[model samples]
Target chain A: MNRKSKDGKILLLQGNEALAEGALAAGCRFFAGYPITPASEIAEHMAMKLPAMGGTFIQMEDEIASMGAVIGASLAGVKAMTATSGPGFSLMQENIGFACMTETPCVVVDVMRGGPSTGLPTLASQGDVMQARWGTHGDHPIIVLAVSSVRDCFEIAVFAFNLSEKYRVPVIILSDEVVAHTRETFVPPSPDEIEIFNRVTPTVPPEWYIPYEDTGAGVPAMAAFGDGYRHHVTGLTHDERGFPSQRSDEIDALMRRFFRKITQGFHEIQRVETFMMDDAEIAVIAYGSVARSSRRAVIDARERGVKAGLLQLVTLFPFPRRHVEKVLQQCRAVLVPELNIGQMSREVKRVHRNSSRVETLNRLDGRLITPREIGDCLIKMYY
Target chain B: MAEGMTGLVHKYLRHDKKFPHIWCPGCGNGIVLGSLIRAIDRLGLDKNKVALVSGIGCSGRMTTYADFNTLHTPHGRALTFATGLKLSREDLTVIVIMGDGDATAIGGNHYIHAARRNVDMTAIIVNNQVYGMTGGQYSPTTPYGAMTTTTPYGMVEHAFDISALAVAAEASYVARCTVYHAALLDQLIESAIRRKGFSSVEVLSNCHIQFGRRNRMASPVKMLEWFKENAVRMHATSKMKPEELQGKFIIGVLADSERPSYNDEYEKVREKARGISVEPKPPARFEG
Candidate 1:
């Protein structure tokens, strides 16, 4: 409980380290993970800090086990988390879906790196943008928050945990290599200023505790393992009794609710920062590290007398379609700069189909897409 | 933590839902589930304190029927999830039930590591020799020369000896049993549950409809009979090598040793965190 509070002053720390500090601030008591590059620092930080705080930290055999451990620990009434990179994140998808189906509250921090495989361990890439949205083979909706800066990494990590617990679903904090490795000044908030959400505990007796029965809040009240509330949770399509139901109607109803629960709150879930969009005829839509580069490009373009604006996406999963539509309605053309070969640009084009011109500026060779490149793309499109 | 014995009959078993257990009639999954329920009853573990974690497979269906804190996780990942449950709630008894395909094939890495760390949990693997749920596919435990839907002629690859694997991986208590030996299996399961470290009980069950029919033991009764005939006690099989029993099954306690369990060792670290010594007070040792 004796945490160091530095009077709201900025302290230099890596993005991964900031995430660890942010999770600690959000009351994360249990961390289970296997080491993977770029994201290993988060696990290392939690391994050293959690035990000292009377919490548990486990280096699991693999990423899959790490995910499983956190889910299990969460059921035991503790806030749990794990961190991984591309390959490990892919391995965790099935269990991530399991957490979704069961409505388990947990946080997974994915430090994005290159590839469909073990592409780049130390290099950064945003290729996992689509994977974060549709990685698991199911219709379940997920909440993914993208962090563009070291400070944003810390804030979003805390926010991810809060949203995860509030919705009784796993919240993913997506950070690419540029944001994960970059060191920046961040102020750790006092406990009073930080918002923390805990899983809703059941007040009903053991016999009356139906694990999957919703409280009309779309999230069922959870009972930790030793609290004596006997309930069942499964990845299979289950009815309100928490028993597996193979019936089509039951499966349909459950799947619909699962997607609707998160998708319905898109207005609340979506977070984007708009710059110079009110007066601009051209816009650049970007997220994560690319967003930072796009911001610089927008600044440079405005100085050069081009009407270019920036739409920086902070929450990537809900896609911020409404915002994209609004921007496209006003702008004549949209430029999406990313580290992948047109992943989010496809989504932008899909939403703004036939309404606006959409162009992509992608770089996948383990190099950071620079502001100059984005500026060049804007200049070419405008002039 | 409370030790009390109760009658074998489980009041929670749904009798109204008779017949069609969702498993093939000759499948050893039913027998394994019976042993599990009996063990729970014998241990008198509060139903509320029992958490059954399972991965995707035919055996995974046990979580649905068992009236307790059941977690049906993804394929081959039950151990990882159960590890979380056990470490988070040290008082609750966490048991993982998974099939051969789920446990040894896809989840093999987790199984070995769970054993190596000796986490305090019980893993019950229903080794039916084939992937029955996915339709007659050869599994990691499928014997050499065994025919399956995938392996039309015969499988040339060797089968995994899960008990031996667990023993080598440092599981504190490792045992093997067959569904035919119901009473003995119940006792083994109960002992494994009571063991203070990571314990693995490989139940050699039958997928009579798939593996059984493919291997010529078509009927459920005949499959159970084959298990009975092939199994020999550890004492009887001591002089024989694994190759000597190529087509046969050997069922007995494989390994038992004393090792510091993950939870007990974790508590020692916790005590140190609280500024207390983990070592008990010792008198001076005399020279021999």
Candidate 2:
């Protein structure tokens, strides 16, 4: 597992392996996670790699602790991450909210498996689409990215870190069982090829550093613990000076800034791939591994003389409403093929002006919705 | 205390922040906090290099007033956060403050596992016997048959002897003292922080407003008196029979031994992973 040469050498790598490589490349210095099926390889790879790179990898007591430790390391001026599946993801929601409220920059990679509970372990599902957005309670902001291919895993892991650091928010990478376990030929990006983003540190003296002051950009420079700033970070609603505040104005300002930072950076944060969308009468909007199948369906449909295109969502939350809306407007009908029962279609339908124009092809029995199944749905909707 | 010592302790407080504090008058949380500050001051610790991590409870508020690198984290999860902080910044002295319920109830798994992991950090479990901030509910350390809002008919569960739990979990250092024993509190906490590996100090403080009122020890003074009378010094406990020890608790160091802390061990792990061998430094507290 040496650092792959950047000489365009195509090496077969699992999605989880690529993600771990990307995180290390993106400067993730600490990883604390619990082992879960489909996601364990990410931790396994990190455990093998992080320590050798002078980074730390710890198998925390549980997912809750894993998320907690990641946030703690991030606050200590290190980029940190944790990976888990559905049940573990549920346990991590509280600390995810803690990261949101305190504006801690960290990455949470949720390798999606089927569930409301322990539904599936060795299976894939996009069921956590909603959970990734609203899993943590509260009206908080989050950034979520989905990886469809092994290459996307490496690139998206880096992208997730950048978004988290820039916004001081918890970024979630949604990779399902298929994407995580699938191995593909990937050319590792050279160090010079990847752009890394680190959180802005305060330039002011320790006496003048205000931990949470909204500095016009809605982002306050962070000072790590033991850096002489000696500032307070808390889960409670805090004022500009980072002390807990009960004042309505301060509370309102904090909430506004949390949201405004992401909303204003929407152009930078939102990413979607429009494939063969031009001159198409019908569109299929999908994400994660299902998007790979959807792309095949669209290609098969086009060969059969149907005016079909694919809208692959690389970023899932902040909802990607603008891209979905455009696809909806341009195409007479839209099909969303996913492993869950209408989880993502619910979002597409929300943005589609005409509700009846959008339909979903769902396969929920621990199996993937194949290209043929999706193509049939698209053809039926076309007719 | 001398005027000079008082000034040193006050220097560690965040004066310009929210003052007058949030504690109800006579609550023992302030006393435990005072003990902690004095202990740190005695050790001559640099405020900048000490991180006070606390979980949700009345005890958690102590981090807010401490003029150190403070983190007020989620309930029952301060140790988890401190574990990460210490692993990354081994130079900082990490001290975790949690309450009875915060440590033993919702956070029980972390409490035992943190001890087992033996990370170099001091955990001050301010055991007030009930959830004071959330209104009096029976906590894990709440005395059996003690009445509370949720346990009006008295509690059915036996109390957790927290210090014993730590000792059983093989923590490097473990001690117990009541807030009534303020001098002992300072001594035990100072030793716990100074020692390497996971150290736990169970400070039996009073939540008179909640736990005390139901048990007829509502006055902070009465609770202190109960602690004073019932707590037998560890040395003296050896002379007492099991029957004589009934309804009494022990105060003093319950466990003390040396072990490789998690941070130091992880450093070795890093060395192994990198295929590099270096002379390991003797385990000692990092000088600020």
Candidate 3:
């Protein structure tokens, strides 16, 4: 298909719809998923657009199969993705870990809704903020990005795919119900301006190729099916040759490297948008929909003579700890507004434990914690 | 047979290793693995284009032994992992190898859905009737009234007829075989791998060390003999109902239908997308 122009004309589309369009533009050719509340629109959009764009889409029976198909398709050398919310995301955990261990490049979009089980399927919640990092039963580094606006959803979707391909690891876009369902004007970048990442493939012949041999980029060049690479890929503690091993030192090295590669590159993956933090004494830390509320609260607080600013997190995982620590050093106190009962608040507190006073404004009634509520909390905290 | 075909088969057959496989001596999983390797050799598939995915189980270990693009995933989630691999790389021949417990119990949901979607992937379930890896625990495929370590008396639950379930779920290809009939099992697996869309071959294997010893089906020879005596061809059983074929086990292809596979349907979409213009649409206000 011909590339679309980046004109300023407004087209009304849902958050999920924008994400699908962005993914298509990013060259995602394979989509597999099972429909779930608040996130089904992403699948619906893909179901319509993928086939028409020379891409593939399959409605899997459940979240587990959805994840499996994406992984399998990725191995066959396609840019693949899947979308889910809450319970479905929970079911995808183990395989998510497998994607991590095997270093497979793929994108997983979680449209967050209130949840412990099926708590509130149609409501917004940041409860999964921490779960996105620790849900899988292993110690592995992860890259998670949160979208606070409809425009950010499209931009972040493309970025998520880029990071997944660049790092050769699963990258997650954490979109809550508020952002997922919300519609906004998004001027997509011109085709030439759009950045894309393709996984590094092996240059050697199949016989000499070792799937897991790190090529100094902290990522091994991959060889998908039809590339004539007869190498094995597994979740087991594999040796450099990709064969399962039982040796303790080998296991330790593999696990250490898996964590080290992403952890070491934290600066590259960490992203945040600071608003008026340069001269503020009090900061409101937030992400996703809560960030939207905090932005307005910060603006009102500033006008009302309160030195309140916003530290909006765009990349959730790796927690942006370094930036939080630096901000805490200058600020007297920080207010965290989240949809869940203090999920990201705990992270903020943990990171800036004794450096600053961290207070939380939490809501879990399946409603967006309004800017007025956050503004009131800022006033009470500062006064 | 043609010289080229024979050479291709010889290339995949792991001949350097002798009869003593890595599996436990009485493990029926080895038989299932044997049948799979033989199937790949017989079909003459390009080793480079074939990928094997497995979950955590005694049978899950099959990927490590086989020479192919093997992926050993987490417990009870092999199908999910394989689904991703297959969808991303349509050119690769994807196969899911799991135990009865892995496929029908822990991973049961994935099985039905994969079949329902008719994805172009092969699911090889090695049904040993028990969870061999975690001691002899009863599995979903464990026959009713069968003795297990967990079920000291007999299993109270009825076994899932996986073949029937797959057929009902709209799987395009479905078949059943036992380790006893090596040649037939090989043929079934080979054909399933070659089939266009979601195909499943349930290999009723033996966990001689666990299930067999508990149920007095201990000897490997006896297990093979039981399969020979019990399993009847689908053609032979068609004339009879469930009552007439009461004690006999039915084997061979149970379902084979033509349907538009996922890849085929997806291609049509891609073609349409290609023909469309890329004129950017105007951005609009997003409302919740």
Write candidate 1's Cα lDDT for A1-383 as tens digits: 11333433346778888888889888898999999998998988886666657788889988888999999999888889999999999988988988888889999999999987989999999988888888887777788889999778878888888888878888888898888888875556777877777778889888787777745667778888778886678887788778778789878877777777777677777889999988999999998988998999999999999999999999888788999999999988899988989988888888876878998988989889899999999998998
Candidate 2 docking band: acceptable
C-alpha lDDT of residue A367 in model 2: 88
Which DockQ values do the candidates obtain, in the order shown?
0.35, 0.43, 0.53
Ranking by TM-score: 2, 3, 1
* Candidate 3 per-residue lDDT over residues B172-265, each given as its tens digit: 9999998888788888998898889999999888788788888888888887788899999999986887887865668999988888887787
The digit string of per-residue lDDT tens for model 2 on B170-236 reads: 9999999999999999999999999999999999998899999999998999999999999999999
Give me the iRMSD of candidate 1, please: 11.8
- How does residue A22 of candidate 3 score in lDDT? 81
Per-model i-RMS in Å?
11.8, 11.3, 4.2
Clashing pairs in 1: none
Question: Judged by lDDT against the true structure, how good is candidate 1?
Answer: 0.85
Displacement of the residue B143 alpha carbon in candidate 3, Å: 2.3
Whole-model lDDT, model 3: 0.82
| Residue ranges of candidate 1 with Cα displaced over 4 Å | A1-3, A7-9, A353-355, A380-383, B1-10, B14-20, B238-248, B269-288
C-alpha positional error of residue B243 in candidate 2 after TM-score superposition, expressed in Å: 1.4
Q: Report the TM-score of candidate 1, chain A only.
A: 0.96
Query: How far out, in Å, is residue A287 in model 1?
Result: 1.2
